[model samples]
Target: MEPSYILHTKLKELVGVHCNLAAPLHFLGIPFYRFAENTLQEICIKRGLDQKKLLLHLQESQKQTVVPSYQSLSKSSVDVVINHLKSTHMWFIRYRLPFISQMIQDIDSQLFNSPEIAEDMKIIFPEFMEEFIHHIYEEEDTLFEYIRKLYKAKQEGFMNSTELFYLMKRNSIKVYAQQHQDDDDEMAGIRYLTNHYQLPAHASPYMKVIYSELKKFEEELMLHSCIENEILFPKAKALEKAVVLKLTQASKLN
Candidate 1:
């Protein structure tokens, strides 16, 4: 089914038909849930990437520089940044990975062709899959874990060593950015799937569903990463820095 039609059908099931564009854009722009569809639409057009394709492509292409310290984060914006990372990056890792992993198995069982293509898929797709999962796992285990620790430290009214925190923060940012780039690469793999798999004239429902979901996932992921790299992360880092300065001053007074 055409993507728009599928989205429309899904929306109709949720609420009686209306002119509202919210639902379609909502799933497609998960972390930046506040953005208007029209705005996002403009961005997609400007980039010459369809909303779906753009989302998938960017998410597949993540490569971020790490910031070593929370000292830079403004106290006020830290919460917002944390929430965004947790919801978009952390939560997505938890939920989406299992679903994608399952789909991979399903695809393996059904989607196959000449031995040559199969071998090619093995080489290309496995690394793509590895990077995608590794990105998620790393964030969950290391990045998010550190964020939690920092938040806890913030709450307890104590600060860690400035230089050490800076070093770690920078590394974390690098790790996170790399993970994001990994996602973009993963989406590229999805594109490869769509192009390479010569679906039988009548693909089975399992095949159809798997590909459809993969397409949607990839598109949204690209949009999400664009927002993060271009708009969100810089703002977050600035906010963190501001917050850290204030905290430093407050401590000095005591």
Candidate 2:
């Protein structure tokens, strides 16, 4: 959020995962730091980006000022964000996780190189997958569906608004957001087992391919969490709060 950081640091160096923001970053004409010294709200106002939307985004930046590379994703409609999230869920659960889980099955005890790798591969990877799958289920079955409906009700806020909003009120975004558990331990084990994903000289081709695929998976996973934590959850929570307040006020009027 500071002028020194924005002007000095490369955009990708700060938050580029799978997303590319180079072209758009360059779009903010000369005098880039004209309002960088101001609050994020003021900077957005000065730069012509939506202030309210960016505020929700910065909240999910691991509490950092370095605006995420997928800031454009934050400005997308709720339904667009939800669809992207669901598709990512499918990619992880149906494809990526299963593929990685199977690949680890043949971790050669003989050529595993490091004893640390051998032990963690057997113990840690399996544990991480089990917990990872569980986390995905919580979102797919409960949270994603709720968010879809919540966004829908927020959009079509009339005929059955009171009832729909009341149902949302009972369930509450706080409940769902609170369920957003930390997944660092799972990825941490992967990093540890792979020796920071650096393939060894004597490693087989299969091991190299597997490690490469895993790096892709890790990048995808980071982008996935960013959308939910930064964009979807905050917008959904705000909408839910507004709906509840409206319902309370209407009840008082009666």
TM-scores of the models, in the order given: 0.47, 0.62
Q: For each candidate, what is the lDDT?
A: 0.49, 0.60
How much does candidate 2 score in TM-score? 0.62
Cα lDDT, model 2, residue 243: 68
Measured on C-alpha atoms, candidate 1 has an lDDT of 0.49
Compared with the true structure, what per-residue lDDT tens digits does model 2 show for residues 111-176?
445646665676777788888888778777777777677666667654364677557756767777
Give the CA lDDT, 0 to 100, for residue 63 in model 1. 32
**Candidate 1: residue 151 lDDT (0-100):** 55
Judged by lDDT, which candidate is best? 2
Misplaced by over 4 Å in model 2 are: 1-71, 158-166
